[model samples]
Target: MASSSTNLNAQSKFDVFLSFRGEDTRTGFTSHVVEALRRKQIQFFIDDEELQRGEEISPALLNAIETSDISIIIFSKNYASSTWCLDELVRILDCKKRNGQIVVPVFYKVDPSDVRKQMGSFGEAFVHHERNFPGEVRVQKWRDSLIQASNISGFHDSRSFRNDAELVEKIAEDISKKLEDLADPPNFDGYVGFNSQIERIKSLLCLELDDVRIVGIWGMGGIGKTAIAEAVFHQISSREYSNHFDGKCFMRNVREESRKMGALYVRDEAISRVLGESNLKIGTLTINSYIWKRLRRSKVLIVLDDVDDNFIQELESLVGQLNLYGPGSRIIITTRNRGVLGVNSIVYKVKGLEHDKACELFCRKALSRKNRSDDLLELSKKVACYADGNPLALEVLGSSLRQKSKEQWYNKLHDLTLISEPRIYKVLKISYDELSPKHRKIFLDIACFFKGEQVDNVTRIQDKPTSLRYELEFLADKSLITISYKRLQMHDLLQEMGQTIVREESEEPGKRSRLWDHEDVYDVLTKNKVRINLFDIIFLSIHP
Candidate 1:
């Protein structure tokens, strides 16, 4: 039972917030529930007279309700009589609506239908309130709150449960299961060749150190940096850190959020999430102060995913300005560019999956089963080889060939080999060509100027008529481009393809729409080329 509770990995200030009528069930049913929660070592908050004596729910009690991951509302005979209990109910319901708090109504000797319809004792309590409070809006609100809460599926005394002790154990078990589910790390279902990388990164993290550690996971796009980081983060979060940190873990797609909102918004959200402070608003002046003040002494695990070169400066500035985090804090950053990581930061370069792992992944994707099919094994190996251990390519190719006949598979494999460019590029082009013109433009822009650039910065660069957010999401869904850490990310192969497309627009370099080659730009400029049809040109000058 103790092991069961520990296994839940539920990240919340309180495991459960017990809402009940003290006079009715405090020493009886509620007391038994409290003892069960205590034996399990679950963190819970049950308001006592000291906290509930005021006319209104105390700020402390309200905070507790908001922070708790789950609320167990005991619907007893006299539950509605206490205005304080009714107020707490309203707050719990509000938290459920706004914060995704889980509410469980335990009908202890009260009928579920009576509670929902406000009949019998529930009706009597409301009637008394109507007479004493005299048609106040507060009474009506409580009634509505009760009706809504009762509709939610929870423990019912008469129908679903009978014995009180048995019910208490069931509730504890159910809560434990919910916590376990919440604490369960991101499913790497069908994930392959990631355990070794996770171990390597974990060793680099050096969790034993008391100092803040910022480790960088760097690789080309589609190399599984994000996946690897996610696995490691969740493993650390659910296993080792749960006991020490009490659920203080924050993982954000920094590129995605930074692009969709802004860098500041991402910064604000990170602080808010780690500190368990929701809807936390901070300006440029106060954001840094707030972050440092809140996080300076707190040990936390933070993962900033999909960082890029363009956003690196902003991140650096933010880190410096905020002076983020206390000692023992660990920040994991996943980026395509190695330059994005600071000099002192430990960097782990994510590599492609091994041949065997790649083959297994391919077979799983293409055959819809992990076990190698005798008929498709040879073709699967060929496809895996073409994928070059790239998980994304394997997935795309495998999915493309799924449920196809052997003859069709052979024809597709032959066609795949005939492509002059890299196999991965050819495979990615399918997704690229599927995009609308607007989405295509967005993908091309990201491949060129906006890759790893913040969303706000990318929006500033585009002269488009419509919002690129939708187009960006479309590209991401198609796997042509990815939005991580709020920045646009493209695989090296896709980037190459985009560049190749621009180059193929015209035979002469000067006639191309975009020119990144320094020699071509120099020839276009210094030689005064006649057909300079370029819309964008990047010139790089190196000093030796």
Candidate 2:
């Protein structure tokens, strides 16, 4: 029953460090556990004879325990008999205390009560150790390590599990679950205003609910909808529901994935991920049945980010496939379009950062140090105002102005007023360009002439009630424009970008599709001739 030395280097680096007595379970129970770990593709380190013969645990074994995120201590009949195994136990416990390493004790063919109390074989082993090395403090330390490790809630093979095979499977399953949790950490560095939003969303999640709760986060682009969702998802996965949920997955940029590989592909991938399977090729025709059957008893937390109308439809179909889910399951969707959310779902509208928050965000992005010169602070506040609380605009403008001189800041601010900054404009134009031709025309008209006009007046001007209504809905759904208090409302930067797009069409105002400038209007009127077709014209006569 002696264990042979195997000096194989860890293939993907060790994730789980195995500590056990080789002569007792190395050939039987421990071997089964190693095979299970291999099938699960879990990296583990188990020492052989070459490592076990030293006066103390080798540096390689100690280093492995220190580096590992998790340690599995297999306590068999004679596990505590060997001084080497006891040394490993002490080192593993040390790692658990200092490095936050997870320690899982599997009582193989041994009772946890016996291990904790140092009774039966464990007591006999301690007596033999004391006699062999009298007055040694190491024996007491080994006993303490065993008691501490055994007290932790872990798999008890003799009491619960039927056999070694079943025990191995359960151990592998627990390891996989813990590994999934350790994979993703919350990333909140330089992330501003995320906590309040996450708190609101968490309130809406109501994790106490047994039934599936779907929460929607809707807002315009660059408003931090996805960022908020990601932060919340990380919190839920790693903290709140880490041990409770059966599985979790965060599918990011769903719109991009849908465009790259259809909505059904995204749906399949999400289901596969939450189900802990990879390359699961379920056809769209039968995916629903497959998902429902697989997830029926499982509690999961899923986050679908950057969803759009098309992807939402696919998501609906995917959810429809699931017949039932375990209680306490939650799904969070982040989308720019409110209409994409289910009517019954609670929707949180993410708005631009408040003035103070916007200023803080801009300053953080613009200045390297916390202490700022008065002039730079003034310039930052002015830029924040120009950004109008848009997170992306603040970031882009702040980064562009970082380390620039005060005069350069003034020059940049002036340039921003005249034309939209390219980076900010490019992002704003995405929502604009997604509009249909009719919707695009309506958005342009609102941006150009009717931004603050009454909605009724704008509708009358357009003179197409049915088309205008539909286009307005489309524009609103796309987060390009808003109808508020019976008036058309649009983001200032969006309006500027729309105007810039029109200006780009023709350098001469007379040759453009729309004319709003005073000099251009005067020139066209004074010429007493129309050179080109004009979509609309506005003229304001001055009172002398």
Candidate 3:
């Protein structure tokens, strides 16, 4: 299950929020709907009578409406008559506009047109309120809220169903089904060559057993450890199994976060997310027994991605090892070093894509052309095999050769002879540093300025059209770039490296080789920054 803090810190407290006039349907239709939703095991919020007594919406009710993933408004004939219900509708629509909350307006025993146009009972209610309320603006706002809510496509109780029981059941089931999207499961579709590893990892997890298990997945950088863990997490935690773990957390890029922040913060964040709580003040000096008791009682699934030897001990030192979690709990730790998890830990080693699988994966990314000639297919197979089945290398090199001519393919293959299969993490940087001075200049220009420009337009803008193509050819040969769909495309790593190089060229933006950031360009043009460096910028192009 996804925690409340999954997306943008939006803490979702309830799956559904029910808004209705208590006096009209509290004992009849709303009761049946609540019972049906309970039978489906859906969490919802239905306002009590105390909430309806106030002229303004209560803070608790407002919070409930704000935190709910979906709002179901029972628009009975007398729904608009209650000022409290009108306020709730306005807030519900406001939430829908602010964050993508789902709103279902059920028109019960009322004409849709009447609610939309503020006619019939809706209009009568508004007229009476407009006269009774001191301020006319509030009443008008309610009228506008009704028109907007009624315009949305939702359940029509009278026309869509035979009776109230059937309609209530349908509503509960539909809402329950819609809540599945909130889980945001990792998608394996369109991904090739991952089934064998995913299945093996699942079998190692041993979720069927009653004992707790700690599985460590270790591989070289860029070997698909994170992808495999994510797929396994989605498969086991999915709603298909009723016995899924009570709590689950996937902490991504733990190494990166530890470098940027501190290890203590990262450890605290992992614990809070796994327990589905916020503001966990678990100090290192004094650990609470209550926290340990709760951890020992609840089943948890945690993925500590990219951790080191010291960090594992840092966590176990506080949580009391496997004894902290309940039986049947599973913790998956991914790292580049297998020794980090200590000797008795169950470990899985991930190898790169095999021969045939590597070729198939490479062809999927590289060759989109339907009419593939024999020579092109042969060259592609040779290049993929040259990558030694390393997924990162194959993808980087394959993408570089996409949508190019036969002669260009031969030249790219020849360039591969100049370099061996380098390590995956430094592949982009090593390729860029090896380029000729002119090639590097052209590459940076495209990276900083014309990323998505047409080939013809870029050449036309350059000083020498013929020489520009030569530089582009070498860059593509090094697998730093690829042209596809009539557009020049460079990898994201290349762009970041180029920008960093230019940034370090000089402190002053105007004196730098390129200007991509808008604020820097504006300051250069408007503020007249004095260039203190003796060197002049070789090329200047604003980011397009």
Measured against the true structure, the TM-scores of the candidates, in listed sequence, are: 0.55, 0.58, 0.58
Model 3 regions more than 4 Å off: 1-69, 72-101, 104-127, 130-179, 182-190, 318-320, 369-371, 420-544
Pairs that collide in candidate 2 are: 288-321
Per residue, candidate 1 scores C-alpha lDDT tens digits across 269-378 of 66656665544667463455545666776877778887765566556754542236767778888887788788658888888999999988877767865645786898
Candidate 2 accuracy as TM-score: 0.58
Cα lDDT tens digits, model 2, 134-218, are 9989878988988899898788655576666777888888997798778746545335766788899999998766777788999
Using alpha carbons, what is the TM-score of model 3? Answer: 0.58
lDDT of 3 by residue, 1-544 (tens): 2212112122337778889988889999988888766654566777655533555765666788898899999999899888888988999999999998999888888898898888988889888897898686878888888889888878854667989988887787678668876755554422458799889988897888877788889987656787788888777877786556766778776764564456677777767766645546565734578877888888988888878765765556534367778898888888888777755468999888887888877776678759477778788888776666666667766666677678877876776656665444344454466567877888888877666667877898668989888777767655677674356776444566778889989988888866766567668868877442221222233221
Quick one: best lDDT, which candidate? 2
Between candidates 1 and 2, name the one with more favorable TM-score. Answer: 2
RMSD of each: 13.0, 18.0, 12.1
Put the candidates in TM-score order, highest first: 3, 2, 1
What local distance difference test score does each model get? 0.72, 0.74, 0.73
Q: Give lDDT: candidate 3, residue 159.
A: 65
